[model samples]
Target chain A: MTRTEATRTGLDLAPDARVGIIAGGGSLPVEIARALARQGKSPFVVMTAGEVDRISDFDDYEQVTLRLEDVGSLLPTLKKHHVTHLVTAGHITRRPRLSAMRLNLGLLAWVPSLLVGVTQGDDTVLKLFVRRIERSGIKVVGAHEIVPELVAAEGVLTKAAPRKSDWRDIDAAHAAAKAIGALDIGQAAVAVGGRAIALEGVEGTDGLLERTRQLRGHGRLAGRTRGVLVKCAKPGQELRADLPSIGPQTVEAAHAAGLAGIAVEAGRSLILEGPTVVARANALGLFVVGLPAAEPAHGK
Target chain B: MTRTEATRTGLDLAPDARVGIIAGGGSLPVEIARALARQGKSPFVVMTAGEVDRISDFDDYEQVTLRLEDVGSLLPTLKKHHVTHLVTAGHITRRPRLSAMRLNLGLLAWVPSLLVGVTQGDDTVLKLFVRRIERSGIKVVGAHEIVPELVAAEGVLTKAAPRKSDWRDIDAAHAAAKAIGALDIGQAAVAVGGRAIALEGVEGTDGLLERTRQLRGHGRLAGRTRGVLVKCAKPGQELRADLPSIGPQTVEAAHAAGLAGIAVEAGRSLILEGPTVVARANALGLFVVGLPAAEPAHGK
Candidate 1:
């Protein structure tokens, strides 16, 4: 549905539409809760312990938090709240090591499939969770559905436009980032003067930016000015759980890295506090562009 | 032809036959010279800068070394040497920056295509150079042609076998390494307890090994007694140049990293100084396996 149509409808969220949210570690869950509140719906936030913070806030929102391993409790919690819709957000910084996670009977039954999916490098666990929620009669909506403006658009978003050389570096960094993403290795790569300086590994984007700065300090960067940082969703990735997102902090990181520009996939990416991020980037003289990744290069 | 057959047949080395050797930074060139000597042929070695050392020995063997960027002079040099067969081996550490290279006219002409090819991460620049050589009437041969024994075979080579847990980590590291290789980002990845700890970048494998050791010393890898290091050729990689090779030093590195095992793609990977490498790995109680990567779960 179009944005205007959806907005006009005012979103038919039940006053007590027990929304189930599989919370990760980030402020996204809090933002999601606020959005749900606007729709007159209260969610049962199943927060993944060690990932989520501010547990007391969940009480204020009339929600509950749960450890990642408490899958058995999750189903009952959803049923208790009569949750008709489910949404998940936030950053699960640490993927529980398969060996370390203690699985209960319900989770044990799904272990074989989960292992197969993970071994295949597919987000099988998340998919299975979604399926379970649907089977329980809960609808799952795109995280952006409640806040469409958070979805980034195609075009230059920063006050400072990229210089010609910055554009060239952006182009190079984009190709490099996609190459890395295609391999499911990382979402971002930092490049300077047509050479890759740092690749994002299991470390998140911020860590990668910090490493880029360090590498630059060691005289490994291409130019004296900061290089370009490019981030994109992996080709054929399961976007619901881990879509690439940037915020004001990302702009600050870019400034610290002395980046010439920051380019992210348009539409597929998220821009938390968009105006603030752009303003910060502009103030730092860092160009930020949301380039269209719709037409991904063929045979990727 | 079998080695014995080729030896008995006394293969002809025409004065006009142009051979190209894409030399990596290692002692493999010396061995290549010995093999070529047996055939009464001396190949011209094209060494990448900052990779190979002691080029003076090549003069004694009637061999010539050229910079990677001197593409304009490469064809003429091959013509001068009457080089017909080309072989590439050793470690060509990925450069931190490409802009510093002084691309000659011939290379400049191919820059656009090369850029697209390189950025696509489908083929290494070394492989691209091989294609250019072939187009210029030079035949590229597998480095193993000179030392067939170096070509790794399927199955465990070391006496010691990996623990069950080590096998799991090895599998995980193998998958992760292939993913990294597919991106043309790196060839090696280290994983302990199913968590990727380090990825090889511009830093050579030895340096990476040392870093892993240091991290282990700092108690970062406390519970994980042994990590698995997986190295593989990039997907659709050109076998003629820069085929991944593990030698005695690799085993030493694994021991230093406190790694339980090292896995490489069978047949596709090279085992330089095979006897010594296997003996050392066995001595260090490290398992070395050459498993076929034909059906690797991920693609380049």
Candidate 2:
């Protein structure tokens, strides 16, 4: 919307540009769509049926539903709507089955890559998908590009600032997050005391927080509290899509897990609704801080 | 018990050596005790009250019970029992609370380190604990030293060997396990479709497997199977305590999680009741292999 603080990808949203959203299951897509609509650019919302959560929110906008197996037809559909730029958002919980795919002539060329990418890490699959869309002449942009205000700024956003002990945890969790990200594993980690206690896997951030919550008063972690949850981008990650993010739900999860705070890489991560997230965190007595991107140590 | 083989720490168990086991809550301690008894060595079992699970199994041996807070008195207690060799086995589910600790003169000297160590990773706390015991003239040995046969051999141990595709998962999971281990985080990881999907955290291996099981049919992991679970010792880890281990329970957990097989670093990791684990794996249609200690990848 009006070149919201030059996108990380250097994307320029021209006045006559048409936007298409490849929506998945999350409120982020809805937020992105709302931001575009408010700026007088109604987006062509596309949802994979059974994978999207906020279907009602996109009802006012021109929308279409496609099955997971019909992802092969998404390019043609976007082209038909004359989409100039694209934003991929939210989680695709339903995987595309090889047997169910309707591989048309055009889709056959890329189906092999899709099949291989699906078996790899989430980022690999996302990169291949984005490349396919970009190759078709529709530039793919991150949802943060549409809502710059949602990007977390450097500092503690909530009323409760992290304590000195929480800073150690922040450092520990950040290192673990980066290590896993480098391996294309996941994007979140929780640290208590002075070391990592939980790591995000394919189960995602919510699951990682839930596991940490359950670990309280068990084993060596008994009586341990004031942990920190950190989410950050993979080192040298593609900034177009799948950047690590947090929202009001993240604050709730961290609080539920008995964590002192939540930290995200400033400017590299998205805050779905900045005010709502801060308000929720403050209400829950959890500090939400945006950490500076760590400097490369000895050029690893 | 006489030495079965040269221990990783070069520990020698003489026939006259009076053994004491600081037992925690798992079958491993029991297995070690049984191995010692089979060799006609009656071990003195020390069980932390409310923390040990296999109490009945040690009734025949000279045993003592103490509260978790009384860990400070353990050195003097070992001296009283004339224990020359010590082994720490199993999981300590209950942490020693500082407020409840009976910090006598000897413990007071190292109490600060204990307090700091407990706040760090498991290895840090364990190294501190073992060093204190070693300072008191008792030699500590790994449980694998008691029964050399318990150490996994470098080969597939079940009827269901890993397929060619599973090898990729093995490499990926091994790399992830080593990465986390290097940070003193944990010792196990699960990789599916050529990338790590789950990692062991403070919740332990069983919890990791359970989380992996719950992750099935969710997000990108839907319909994925034949994953690999890998466990290995931490890089440059103190070998006398906390050697990564597996047993029949591990086999069951892996099978239940739809994993294709289980792998542990050969010689560095233990397979409690090895024959039983292999039989269980064979029956469950799962493979159990012991990978040779990974060569340093271009000198890490």
Candidate 3:
């Protein structure tokens, strides 16, 4: 169907129509926006509070501010701009206070979901967000869909490839990371010497790394310095929002935290500043590899 | 089978036969030894080196010290005492250097499982240990099998019961803890405000609690302190070894960590110093509940 036809009827349509980007924290939203704009499509961005959304850089798109609690106005805003497709990038770790939300018609419609979402894990809430947007006649697209280059490719992405020993750590971390995702706990897990040293929690990757670093050798035995940081999509995850991403910052943090390398899920993970990240990791003598989807069967 | 009959041959038998205790760290081994002695059985104790196992108080047991690397002596020692049944109690977080081992015929016999065990998580190694002992004509029993009082009881354990809101945190922590267990990563998980704040890693439950305390409010949004500490058995865990245990130390830590309560898998978990644990929990106004085996179906 034509874009105008889909917009006028306020019904579902292919992603070829107008894309609305709901930007959260991090540089992902800006990248998604630029990618969409480069494709000659207009994107109306709803910037959440505490996000790195400086929308003035975009000359072809419109921008609006929306607190997480004020999610009610999101639907009307999308409808007002004739948005038929939507994209959510970055993350929202802090939950919004229910009482503080504006409680508009759209938000009111999702009260049940939001109520359940409050006590649920990050994936469940993100899934709810996607369902809410899709229910409003907007199709949610992963930012990677708009820019394939952002998605990590299979195999090594740095000069220093993972050694044979590191593969064990990678597989271990990958399995633990998947288990974390399956439980909707988090996306990342740290493994040292084939043992999971830490799993990402609400405190995030940085905190997980920091705790691992501090507690590594603090146990009865010394913790190994070399480990792999595996970030992968949860077994059941909403791909549109919060697909695990790695940037130069992650590389620096992993290095600082004494990890030997970073391993991300191939084709499903995002690697921002890919070349810079690779070069930086190579400089730090750290490896960055994208693991294939079909993980080797764990022998244990 | 009669106790004497079972000890005569290299065959598996119930723990009612002659029992041997492999004591690691902490006071649990002492408790188990005492329980077995009270049951009119002469228990042989192999205290792992670096453990706090001073068995002078025991009048009815033979004791020997063995370094972790000297695992080869374990089987021979068990057979010398006519130990047809065994129990492993307490904790051991540090792994031994395989190269430093004084490999004996028994340790060499189980070298394959030990090699596999070295790279696997705690549960796998514990499972291997159980298999090694059982294969050597000795049956391993959980410490709880000797001391029924060690197992936690159902429902609120202290005067202070979990308030309605704490249930959400309990469920969240329980799910995360189980996931940690399913992956054979760790035994405990802490949640606050419906978010998994920390997961037990190699650092153990105490370390997990400490990290949660330090990183609770350190997240993007202030993490709620009114969550729970849930310690459950890992999926497919060999109940004979490393069943999650909490005690007065746990109560003190939970109180200091500012948690609302502590929840544990009722039938599968151990409560060391139960009266003191309950008393401390009550004094701190923190709830300690033995959660039922069946978890409420997670809404997510």
Q: Top model by lDDT, which number?
A: 2
lDDT of 2 by residue, B69-181 (tens): 77767888899999999998887866777777765886686686676786577677778777788888998777766766677778887888889989999999999999999
lDDT of 3 by residue, B113-228 (tens): 77787578667777888887888788787776677677777788778888878998898889889878887788899888776767888778888787767765663434355778
DockQ of 2: 0.67
Q: Lowest summed lDDT over 10 consecutive residues: which window, candidate 1 chain B?
A: B1-10
Report the lDDT of model 1 for residue B5. 30
Q: Is the docking of candidate 2 incorrect, acceptable, medium or high quality?
A: medium
Interface residue Cα RMSD of candidate 3 after superposition: 2.7
Model 2: runs farther than 4 Å from truth? A1-11, A295-300, B1-12, B295-300
What ranking of all candidate models by DockQ puts the best one first?
A: 2, 3, 1
TM-score of 1: 0.73
What is the lDDT of every predicted structure here?
0.66, 0.82, 0.75
Q: By the DockQ metric, which is better: model 1 or model 2?
A: 2
What ranking of all candidate models by TM-score puts the best one first? 2, 3, 1
Error of 1 at A269 (Å): 2.6
lDDT of 1 at B206: 69
Candidates sorted by lDDT, descending order? 2, 3, 1
- Comparing 1 with 3 on DockQ, the higher-scoring candidate is 3
TM-score list, all predictions: 0.73, 0.93, 0.82
